[model samples]
Target: MPQTIQGFSRLNKEEKIDWLTSNFLSDSQNATSILKQYWNSDAKLQQLHDEFIENTVTNYYLPLGIAPNFVINNKTFAIPMTIEESSVVAAASKAAKFWMSRGGFKAEILGTQKIGQVHFTYTGDAQKLSSFFELTKSILLNDLKTLTASMEKRGGGITSIELINKNDQLANYFQLHVTFETLDAMGANFINSCLEQLAESWQREYNNYPVFSENNAEMVVIMSILSNYVPQCVVRAEVCCAVSELTEADGIDPEVFATKFVQAVRIAEVEPYRAVTHNKGIMNGIDAVVLATGNDFRAVEAGAHAYAARNGSYSSLTHATIENGIFRFWIEIPLALGTVGGLTKLHPLVKLNLEILGNPSAPQLMEIIAVAGLAQNFGALKSLTTTGIQKGHMKMHLMNMLNQLDATDTEKSKAIHFFKSNKVTHSAVDSFIKNLRQN
Candidate 1:
């Protein structure tokens, strides 16, 4: 019989690894390799290792935290995420607990398809390229058949292709939007490859025209290089718990809190300055997961901000409201992420983290991330509405400061006590340590 290891968090690093090896389900050898690689003493390797150990890489298995009570589309899922932020996990769990008091999170993914664009520009004739797309739309669609076949077999395919002339002066550009169902993957690479092939075809077909110069015509510019226009997959959670349940946690008025939270988001949507931070709050969760999974966080960041400003103004990624005495939350983002190829396979720790997730396919992984983002947003908004964001975040920062000081357990306790008492400073901590030593 397998022995149950209780409270692994209380154990030392080595003890935790040992427990993981004996009973926790994971790739033991891989896990051991990553631990050893970082635990070594080589300076450069050690530096990289330390970064990995921290929340630097999101996929480097720190702890698998779960947000329980998430009822999406009538199914309950314990959403597992790898993130190191202090209040994110706690807040999400709190939100889920609150929602459980009502009907839970009712969510639906509109479709798993994502759109990628290939841009064509020529000085001579926009009309010509426009006509060309009209004439060769079938050919372009047929070329994507192999690329999209697997998705097609799974009840998804390259559904539509459209050509739009972007009004611009530097170059007359035609944007081709290819929509394909990605099943459960993020679909960046798949969509990019498809667009690459399309661009190559455009070059071959329009090579004869002087204005369509490969050297000067700007024949292909893959704008929105990654997929956007994600079919709106709406995930919503509403709970009708008595205002009583709110008291058990922190004496928060669920109805009043929810109403105030919605108002804050409305302010963020209408105001550019607030919109920046509002979206940043969303990215706080997104960037954490993107880093953990070994995906390009910068790209996701760029895409998210661009998507927020798609309507010519910055706006909040999530909308919140209280209806019928229940808190309702909804989020939509251009989450361009992937599970196959790239860093997902290149990095050792990323592989380990994915394994912890049971190596979910792309779409499943996206769903998990989407929910995590929603949960994280809830965490931030709730904190801002109830207690203010800095209170909880600053306490976590104080703990980090103590860790950096390399204080002993006793020293840490003393330092924290002094810090809270307004007597702690760099010089003060030094004096306290010196006094302790002298005694």
Candidate 2:
């Protein structure tokens, strides 16, 4: 039974933890200790973390790792990834090295447009509204000149605005569909601000417009917000190599692997079940880098998934081709990242990660993220088509299993050496540890 408390946010950090643990946790003291244990030792740093969100109890930490040897567009980079999952960093590094010898990855931004909308209800004639919109569109744009001055100076601002009629879908529904270009920033704040201002200006005009007044109808402004599903903010990254170069020492044929990999991608393209996991693998890489760089992974994820389902059915974000002794694998995804906003300036680690990548611009970051996704997908598909996913994944997971079982360093060393030639499983490792301890 949970008790609701008023002004929970007003409580201090320790007080908040006390209430949460007392109500929810069985071992309140232990949980409180664990939460406090992760807090930063430095007072300033701890305060920074606390102010990031409401109801702050303590910090939650994830491993910040580096996957080196990535060469995108002929430039080498060691990308930082913050994730709790095992084997993702390993797979990305392996795939990057594989492509490095094959001319590296080629990537480019396809588009950089973001959108926001103002929804409202009008019970008047659609034709009259259209005429009114046409007449006042310039006035509405002019009203925002002051608001958009700084953005326009920075080479980004409102690009277009359209009056959309949705009365057929819902009675008296309409929208102001606005597009923008906000270079070097995610622009959520900027987009929403412009939408709100536009809504304010548009409503004032609506009140004065005689057409709706003559019909004794009123236009009610609803809400204004920036959309995360930016289908227009897309980047493409790919790797290509001579078929002969894709050789494995285990005697798997390159052509056979390529064919199987392509088929696997094809299965994901048509099957929703497979597409979800297939895309998840890609996102494992994309989201890691996005988070490491201090951008919004949730927004990137939403946009990417919506873009994949743009054809009315969910499909793969990656594609493959084999022709003329050449094999090419690629991914195209919507990644609206920012290098100049949000946590980019606040988080210390984010600053270091950006420096590690040579301080790439927003579009450049998009290219890198897309390449990461493609590399991850390639690594996964290759493993799935050849040696099986568990062989490598479980091997990487052995350390975690050892930690869970509380094995000593000697036992862990023995287990690592033993599992090199043997398949890794929970029971086998448990038994190995038990037997080694007995002997």
Candidate 3:
């Protein structure tokens, strides 16, 4: 039975682990050993990792892979991907190689505006609030001088602020909508800090203005935060080639492949169930690169999914078409990523990953991430149209299954040889191992 304890956080790392294992785990010694096993060898580095979050226990790890021969904008790159899934890097690499011979990928940034808001409530005159906001907009900006000065010096700062009235949607609710140009940084902290300052100034300014005293109501500040759904921070990436070029050794006709591919994409666009899985494959590539580069994958994911449903229906983020003998595939996603801030500055692998990509700016990073998604989507759709998803995915998953079964070196070698000509599945591998051991 678990019991409450005071100041569990104040305990040392060892004490914390001891308490956790003693209270919760049946095998406390092994649990503690496992936790310590993942700790960094370098004490300083381990301390750095520990400081990343509160109640520090240990590190969690994922494999970092290199998907080579990605040619975007006529520039070749080997993107770094950090993920645990089987076949993601392989699929991405295959698609990248296929597109490399064609025109490669062309990408462009559509926009770079990020949004934050201050939610407040007031039963006062709506007209009076609007007029006051118009007059006090400069005051709000003036109050953020200290906050925006550094960002402005780098050619990015607050762009606009507007008063949004939402009384009909929710009683006495209003918003101070603000947009920003964050340049290279993801700017979550910067945006949030500026919003807090703006909120404080707004309350102070509203209280000082005696014109609001007639209403006998207070302007209540609800919350100030940056939004993860950044529709404006979007990028587009595409690949195009002659329909004949799509033909391969698999004997699938280029015209048939193109038709099937476009149909697959169309199904995803209309069917929410298919669209969800289709987009998951796209994010397999995007999230790998995003995580390897130390950006917020969760934020990018939320924004992308929200953008897919922006038209009142959840649809595919990727589009496809075959026009006049030209087959084209593309993806457009809202990815509010950063190359400079957050974990980029601290994690060693993130630094190297950024350098490997030639140190892209935030917009440039957005472009590369978008291209990864497109490449991954192409790989998945091509497999779905031609051989089938399982043929390659299960083959790639064979090693992981073998590892899980703890097959010996000789058993693993035999299993590899056998599965080369046979289909792979959990029961098949288990039976193969059992026969090998018995014989």
Q: Which numbered prediction scores highest in lDDT against the true structure?
A: 3
TM-score of 1: 0.70
Candidate structures ordered by lDDT, highest first: 3, 2, 1
Which residue runs of candidate 2 sit more than 4 Å off their true CA positions? none
Model 1 Cα lDDT, one tens digit per residue, 255-342 = 6765677899899889999989888777766676677787777877776777688888988888766656555567777665678777
Q: In candidate 3, what are the lDDT values of residues 1-439, reduced to their tens digit?
A: 9878999999999999999999999999999999999999999999989988899998999999999999999899999999999999999999999998898999999999999999999988999999999999998999999999999999999999999999999999999999999999999999999999999999999999988987786799999999999988889999999999986726898899999999999999999999999999999999999999999999888899999999999999999999899998999899988888789999888999999999999999999999999999999999998999998999999999889989989999999999999999999999999999999
Residue pair clashes in candidate 1? 58-291, 58-292, 59-292, 73-107, 102-240, 105-237, 184-362, 184-363, 185-362, 185-363
The residue pairs found clashing in candidate 2 are none
lDDT of 2 by residue, 1-439 (tens): 9899999999999999999999999999999999999999999999998988888889889999999999999999999999999999999999988888889999999999999999999988889999999999999999999879999999999999999999989999999999999999999998998999999999999899887888988799999999998888889999998888898623789888888888999999999999999999999999999999999999999999999999999999999989998988888898888999799999999999999999999999999999999999988998999888999999999999999999999999999999999999999999999999999
Whole-structure CA lDDT of model 3: 0.94
**TM-scores vs. true structure, each candidate:** 0.70, 0.98, 0.98
Q: Count the backbone clashes (under 3 Å) in each candidate.
A: 10, 0, 0
